[model samples]
Target: MNKKNLRNFLFTNTFFIVLFLGILMVISLFISSNILFKNIYDSTIQNSVHSISELYNENMKYFEYFSSKYQDIVSEILDELYKNYINNIPFSSNLTIENFRKIGIFKNVDYYIINKNGIIIETSYDKDLGLNLANRVPNYWKKLNEELNKNNKYIEGISYEIKTNNPRIYGYLRMEDGNIFEIGILIDERAIPNFPKTVSSLNLNFIKSIYTYNISFIPYSFEFPLLDEEDKNIFNSLEISKGEIKTYTLRENSNGKESYVYIKWVPDKVNNKEFNFTVLTKISIDLSSIVILKNSIIFIFIVLIFFVIFSLALYLNYMTNRIEKPIMKLINNIESGKVDADAETNILEIDTLIKYYSHLVNTLVEKLKEEERDYLELKEKLQMIEKEKDLLYEMALKDDLTKLFNKKGSVQIIQKLVLNKESFSVIYLDIDNYNNILEKLGQNEANDAILSLVEIMKTIFRDRDFIFRVDENEFLILLRFVNLSIAQKILKRFVDALKKFNITSDKPYKISVSYGIIEYKGQNIEDLYNEARNKMEMMKMKKLELLKKLSDVNAEEN
Candidate 1:
């Protein structure tokens, strides 16, 4: 074939081949990304389903443990009451109730006792103390009593919204002497203290409902719904089989977000009465998170793929330039008026290079500008973040009144010191009779006195140490590298400094200060403050007692 025909055939074939390959690469990339995403989604779904199931099981375990412990507490309290005042009529007296309240059992538990005739004889809770149980007794109580009478065993079961109209789990123990006394413990739904803290950290947005049913599958409460209509119909159509985990898809009416309802059956035997309890946990994906993650991954993948392709194209262009180096040199020579000298040589390569160079150069220049703009925007964002951090530090740490480090600043410094295991002492001081001074000398004089105290405290404490006004009359001094002995010596010096704290007012009163010192030992800030406050209160109380005794002695002398 002639050189012109051959060149045309090669160029057309190469262009078609590259176009087909690009299309195939794009489709393959998309298909692979989608498959990978689906796999990740499926794995996450499986993990979430397993985790939620475990959470449900753990919740049941907690309920069981709570029931057993609650039963033991109730039984112990009843036994104590029976042993101490069974024959005594004063069991119904105020003194007995007061004593029970003081013992901490009544404070922590809600309990009521019923006699053999199903009458509420006594209750730890004040509201139900004198209430009759005849009308208010739940059907569960009757079932419990029947079991107690027949089997002579303890009855325990979970119920919902009975008399108090709230979910509760009850455990009853029959006394030994056929007294038929029953103890009922009310479960607090507000605080599921036994529930695992880890579950709360999962950030699950769902409600769990658990219900107990008899062997006949008749639910006693509305805590959990029965299986859906279709599932119920299927269940009824088939012979009753053993319990199983069932999942149903629940579709939203508005936005069509997918949700799942999971139900598991737990067979329980309480008081010889077989019961099938169903636990229903409803879980839904955070649609926002799902959308955000999906879009973000896709966006990132596309950007990355485009970057790879663009980079590859640039590299291919450089390679093409190397391969077309002779053509480029010939074109440059022709442009410089030297092409006629090489006109006898091959001109096909030079012709093709001239055809594409103008378009390629324009595209590369625009790409460079876009990249530079993105880089500048990123740098501006970093600078803004640094400025915000500085602003936050100034606002949080500086005190408005004295323009010094405030309580927050002191806390930050102290936390760092404690975390680094550095030795320190905290001297908590309160202006004695500051409130009285405010009342007697007025607000203006009190303000001046406070300013004077702050000035004196700043001068006495080291610049490295922190001084903060914690309250209207109380201040804290954080002294670094100080032991208890040094803290006490510093406290003595602080007391002497208080004598010099004077406001230049017409009605100037002497400023007296009381301080409590605590050497830091890696204790929590709250605990340190509490210890210091307790000591300060004791010291103030002793000073008052001494003054009272002196007054008594003066009266005797008179």
Candidate 2:
């Protein structure tokens, strides 16, 4: 409605947008920080889980290296037992548990003979007698059955005695009678030469260095120092879901720090690719520092971001003030009839707004041109009436015979256009040998010839062009909006038309013309007319010289 109202409306919308963008930026920053820190926490926890899983694999290497030496003895004992069973020898008569211990390789080994029903029917240790292994540990029973399905293949698993809780390295082999031959070697019997202790200590140090607060190892239900089928399922499920044997979950810790529990599946790593089972490994990590950093980032960025937005809001209002005044003034000026075409505002908005109402501006300009046209028409009518009065009285404005303008009227018309800086061209024409035509033909025919020439000139030129008989046989033509080359073409058209007329004329002599044309070049009409006369004289001299050359050529031919 008004400049003030318009500016206030723009300011209100601009402020609302700035406030909306500012709030949006703060929210996005906080959300981005939270997501970034959460990813960092998850990545750290996964790393810790990998490191501890690798440590477990490294410790198992020591157990494998030490236990392998005893593994050869158990294999040799199984070869002897399989041979006896093949020869149809009864195990009850030939090989008692005491008799088997008498062999040098079997003395340190405690062997259990598990029948097809998974019951330990025979054993070197009395405590393992009549034990149902399938019921107590079904996971281990399944592993023992897999070993029995193969020919002399064995797997080593560390298990504690069921009743006594003594640690043992157990290996399983299948008998020829579909029974499992299970053997155990005491950990005290096979020593790792301090390597396992060093590895264990290193693992503890590495875990402490990684910021793991507490770790618990639970596989399915109870903690067992065994890699079983359940752990492999967890490993396979994680591998399928995550493309690796690792997964993690987030939780709040008791001490108000953020915690992540990472579950990783570690393979038995026996032959690199063949895994009998996998261990379900869990690692707990803290992210207190990461949380603090995220909080600080949110706080500091909010303050800095809000400060930046406040400055922008002020700058927007300032720029609005700079833009409003020019546009209002331009709009008011455009509504009026006067326009300053050379006015300076140095603002693109004002110039653009002026052009925006182009229809109204164009209508105003056309109305002014219509008024000027009417005034010009009235002035031309008055000049015509004044010329008629002069023609009737002294024959000074229009030539008495041809009725075209004479020198006095022609001078006034051309000088007026020249002072107005209009573009035009002038052609000066001289009728060749007009006096001879007048002497040979009578006065009436000569006048009729001049009148015919005038009519020809009138027909060739536009109504806007002026034709003047300035001298007795010389005429001048003023052609507006015509350049020098265009006037020359017009002269050529008139010459061709005259040549056709002469061919068909009944007169005794032909009418020929000498012409010269020049364009106005910021000169007064008098100087321009004189220059045309000089061009006409040059044309006549050129014609005379051409005639003399033809006469000399004819005399030479004679």
Candidate 3:
């Protein structure tokens, strides 16, 4: 399977149209030549058969007239004799043969009165008087009898008598007296008329002129005229079947000369028997006279056909390119993924199609842009919503003032550590005397101290460690993947950092915090937190007792 694009296909087929036309012209010429030759062959056969049929009909008509006229004459004479003489005359009265002879019934013919036994009892020719029809011409009489039996009327046909060797048209009438009255007329050379030989000669000349050949009519079982052994062989090769009416034409090669031979069978009658003859014609075309003329005509016709086809091809190319150029441009636009150009055409349907296509492309472009814009806008909206949600989540987890994780955040971290069974420690820290400081200074100063403490704690701890404000005055830190020593170190560092940090207040007093530490190893979060808070309360109480001891010593010294 060869693949071709539209432009290549159009250009290639434009030239092929000329080739197609040439083939068609050749086929038509062949068919027309065959038809013309067939007509000539058919006409020749028809004329030959027609002439023979006409001659046969003329002979039959003459025979019918001769036999019917004499039969009526004999019937009337017999009827008159039976009515006036044979019927009224006495039985002793004799109806002599001279009576029939005198009436001229036997003047140029033979007459016989045959009895039921086919015995000829009376005859105009005395020599045939004692001959029986059965012994002499039995089949002929039997045929006659069969014909007569059909209609019981007079019947006649041409037959020959075996004894006399006389070819005669014989008619017989069976009379009421149980006798058959028969009449026979000798058939001479003029009996069957011959068609004019000049007509045959003229027909031969006509056939020669048209077919450029020679013809010969050969009677069946007769010697052919001066044919060579090869010619005889050629004729013998054409085996004409019996009873075939249609003429046959064959192509023959004789002495290296190609010829067309036509054979036809012509039937004729001899003594009531049908026989066939053949008319064979061998036609060899002499192309010398018409060859130049035929070639010239063919050349002119071919040139004309080529010129017409060439012009048509040119017009087709023009039209195909006209349509293809615009379509190609439109295809290019589609393939390039953009519609920056449009196609123009003069043809109305093409123009309409281009316009509709251009509109469709433009609409599709606009729709695609709209879809992209909508997608981008939706993406932006989703991003903005995601950012707002993140801010809200941060606000929910962190304290508003210190921006540290609240009690809920502390619980979340502790639950995560417990679920993971992490090795970590929780250190619960509280600002000591935070209520006293809030009463002494202002709420704003107290909040500033807490924020100041949160910054100090962030500096002492690593980012991985969790630090979150649990309440107003309390905070918790989770150190992950650490032991008791790491927890103590982290708590001591936080306490030391708090001692040096001063509060930003009018009094400018330092803030102190109590710390409680415990190692966390997948412990219940609530129980671990409560135990650490209890330890912080015990530390606070020990510090207060030591401060009271210092105060009593100072009072004694004063």
Q: Which candidate is the best by TM-score?
A: 2
lDDT of 2 by residue, 1-558 (tens): 535576777677888888898999999998899789767765666666565556656555555554565566556655555466558665542344355554332324466788988899987678879998788667657866775566466746443345543345566777667787776655442343222123223343114222211012233222223344543454335431121434544445685355534354433545432223233343435467667777888999999988988888888889888887777777677666446667754446556877877978899899999999999999999999999886575566888888778999898888788778789999999987788889988787778788778877877888989999998899999889889898888888788778877898786778878888999988767788889998998998888899999999999999
Q: Which residue pairs of candidate 2 clash?
A: none
lDDT of 1 by residue, 1-558 (tens): 635533334444555566566667767766876676556555655566566556655465445554554555545655555555456544443444354453332323344566766666676556656565445545445766677777654536443423343335444556675544444434445545322223324543332222333223344444434555654443334332222333433334263234443333342443333322343333344344554665677677667766766666666656655656666566677677664544544466656777789779889999999999999999999999999999898778876666666777777877888888899989887888888889998988787777877887777788878887777787788888889998787777666676644444344766777778888876898898888877877788888898899999999999
Q: TM-score of model 2 relative to the true fold? A: 0.40
Q: Name every residue pair that clashes in candidate 1.
A: none
| Candidate 3 clashing pairs, residues 3+ apart or interchain | none
Question: Which has the better lDDT: candidate 2, or candidate 3?
Answer: 2
TM-score of 3: 0.36
The numbered model that scores best in lDDT is 2
Regions more than 4 Å wrong, model 3: 1-358, 502-507, 555-558
Model 3: per-residue Cα lDDT over 1-558, one tens digit each: 998888677877767866797769967765675565556545644664454345434454454455455555555544443444335453111243345554332324556778887888976667778787776546546766776677555534443344443445555667778778766555553443322222233343123321211123222111223445565455556544233334445554453223444443333343354321233333333223333444566677778777887788788789889988877876775676544523443355567998999999999999999999999999999999999999999999999998888989888887887787778888888899788879988798788878888888899988899888988999888888889897897788787777666533344557888878888755677888898898888888888998999999999999
TM-score of each candidate structure, all chains considered together: 0.35, 0.40, 0.36
Lowest lDDT block of 10, candidate 1: 207-216
